[model samples]
Target: MTLTLTSLGGAGTVTGSRHLLEYEGRRILIDCGLFQGYKALRQRNWAPFPIDPKSIDAIVLTHA
Candidate 1:
């Protein structure tokens, strides 16, 4: 079994928070908030995701 963690957002700033976890044969996502604040951060929202959305098996939001 193998485990991998990737941060889709919430790296060098606040607002949008997303974390992708892949283990075994499953891919789980935690947090799916939108970016808000500086233009640069917000612009990130428009960019394509680092990973494929279809590759994700499930999504679990820790907060609203």
Candidate 2:
């Protein structure tokens, strides 16, 4: 399986944070954190994640 990665948050903006990971026929999510300090950033949490949560096999949060 091929691993894929996508930045869901904290890239274009500095508010909410989210990351999507896929590898070896497995999917994972990292740092489903909310961005603080700005309304635009905070609104990201309300948006849908690019990938379905049900497909996630693991979650790894570093200081999340």
Question: Relative to the true structure, how large is the alpha-carbon lDDT of every model?
Answer: 0.87, 0.76
As for candidate 2, its clashing pairs are: 15-35, 16-35
Q: Which regions of candidate 2 fall more than 4 Å away from where they truly are?
A: none
Q: For candidate 1, lDDT tens digit of each residue in 1-64?
A: 8898988889877788999998998999888878999888889889888788898899998877
Q: For each candidate, give its TM-score against the true structure.
A: 0.87, 0.77
Count the clashes in each prediction.
0, 2
Tell me the lDDT of model 1 at 38.
Answer: 83
Cα RMSD (angstroms) for every candidate in the order listed: 1.1, 1.7
Cα RMSD, model 1: 1.1
Where is model 1 more than 4 Å wrong at Cα? Answer: none
Q: Can you write out model 2's per-residue Cα lDDT over 1-64, one digit (the tens) per residue?
A: 5778888778866555678887888877888878776776667677776777788899889773
Least lDDT summed over 10 consecutive residues: which range in candidate 2? Answer: 9-18
